[model samples]
Target: MHTGDVTARLAELLLGARCPGCGAPGMGACAACAAGLRRMQPFGVGGLPDGLPPVTAAGAYADTLRAVLLAAKERNALGLLPLLGGRLAAAVARLVLDAGGIPSLVLVPVPSASAQVAARGVDLTTSIARTAAARLRSAGLAVEVLRGLVLARRPEDQAGLTRIQRLANRAGAFRAVGPPPSGPVVVVDDIVTTGATLAEAVRACEVGDRQVIGAAVVAATMRGGGAR
Candidate 1:
């Protein structure tokens, strides 16, 4: 088969018959969508779970950006890593600067449930966290990807769950492992809906006195009025 034919078939297998970012037929993540993922406007999130560090989203989860994120996350569009990772790095940069003279950043990704990982055959959040860390390092920031957090217990899926239900579902979902981090920590996730998961991550890290400076996400849902 021709290269374009192979690509189109791949897109069909992974993300239907059209581009996720624009629904363009016979394409897998069009170039225009890749370019659209570059800009990131970090903003503070509100209504966080208590004891959760302040969180920032690279951008609102809407329009082309949402499509791009879902493309990379759900549809296995690995080619969009630089564009998506660049935006995540921007959010992490803002957190580091706001934190003031933080020598290095330790990124702890919110762990995926074992079942989910098995079903997907890939750990998407961890990949994004690593990508974000690399981007930060390229921009002259001290960065480390710490797989410090793990899922303590399987919880019901957050989809269709109410805000309170989400908070309860993730209350004890995460725990920190390995030696205590010597420096500050920043939890990273692909998306934040009600901030419950991020909060759980913060609480897990703090169980051992590790200072969680902040959290960063690729995008956040505006319906909860969290990301401003």
Candidate 2:
């Protein structure tokens, strides 16, 4: 098993398998948080303010969800990514099904800057996408992970950047290493703040034999607030 699995099991044992966001002890998601998150309907984006693929987010980017996302992405709390990524993957899978049919899902994680991944001791989004792929496979879906894509530039952090600025910064920053494997490619990210990053990733993958299908993220900051 991967480190994510080990951490997830440990978290479940220590936290009573509770929803990390709301402190609902005893289940992966408590009724309240689940209801709230679910209420943040999976909205379609032409792309984030950035230029990523159409994104489907599990929840908004604040409050309980924010805490969970920070823990997973910033604090080296790897366990939460599986929980969060799995939810996003499920939502994405639904969209795939609704669109027509399920193609072999190839998870292409949006690459983080090498410096940031080095600081974190791992590629956060890649790891989360891997876990999500595993979960999707376990549910009897065909899936695989491809990290053949690489970054050609390191754009500045997008925290306060406007959508246009973010898009301009990320333009042409990604490049594919080789021909993509045969399947529908879905770019995965931990969060879709503006979407500049994800869009570039999708564009890079489209250069090869890959069919760009969609994108998914654990959370997205709503224009107004919260996920809903």
Candidate 3:
């Protein structure tokens, strides 16, 4: 069974079927929460971190979307993958179109530290990326997922850091392993608060002599903030 399947099953056994967005009783998402997710009509997100590429988001990081993402991150809400994965797939399509219709694509997930994976019992980024890739492939798009990037060094937790501090902490923090990604690449992550992490992923691809076409996120913090 997939790790997501195991996690979701465990959650159901321990806590019953509950909506990741509203905590109402249901599998994956309750009908109301499912209705809450949709593609942003204007998909482009502004104010990227320096050196970050043009990107798209499934939704702003607020409301029901915020609840769902945090559920997948903090709780074992893997049952919600179908919903979240759909959101990510829409974002990737928008990004590909913005990049002038890339012929084919590889999705590279930003790695979560081994410690985080151990503590959480799931790699949220990779799981979601694979889910999105599966959805894209079913739609007849050529999509692949590569998950070989690792953090070169550990940085302090980013919760309270200023934008500049985040950039400093993650600078040169990622490197690709097991040969580098080739063909057009799109870096995938669950969320983007300041884009520090995503920029580093792009840099890692550059270091490996690859260029990221753009990035796609399940959601992004839409509040105003500038990156240095």
User: Which prediction has the highest TM-score against the true structure?
Assistant: 3
Q: Give the residue spans of candidate 1 off by over 4 A.
A: 1-18, 25-28
Could you tell me the lDDT of residue 140 within candidate 2? 82
Q: Rate the local accuracy (lDDT) of all candidates.
A: 0.79, 0.71, 0.80
Weakest 10 consecutive residues, lDDT, candidate 3?
Answer: 219-228
Compared with the true structure, the alpha-carbon lDDT of candidate 2 equals: 0.71
Residue 127 CA displacement from its true place in model 2, Å: 1.2
Query: Model 2, residue 149: displacement in angstroms?
Result: 1.7
Which order, best to worst by TM-score? 3, 1, 2
Off-target runs (Cα >4 Å) in candidate 2 are 1-20, 23-41, 46-53, 224-228
Candidate 2 lDDT, tens digit per residue, 1-228?
876556656777886565657765443545576566556656565334433345677666778778777766676666566667666776577657766878577888877788889888889888887877888888788998889688898777666777778778888998988776887888777777666777788888887557877888777777732111
Off by over 4 Å in 3: 1-17, 39-42, 225-228
- Model 1 TM: 0.86
Of models 1 and 2, which has the larger lDDT? 1
**Would you list the clashing residue pairs of candidate 2?**
50-194, 50-196, 51-199, 52-198, 52-199, 60-227
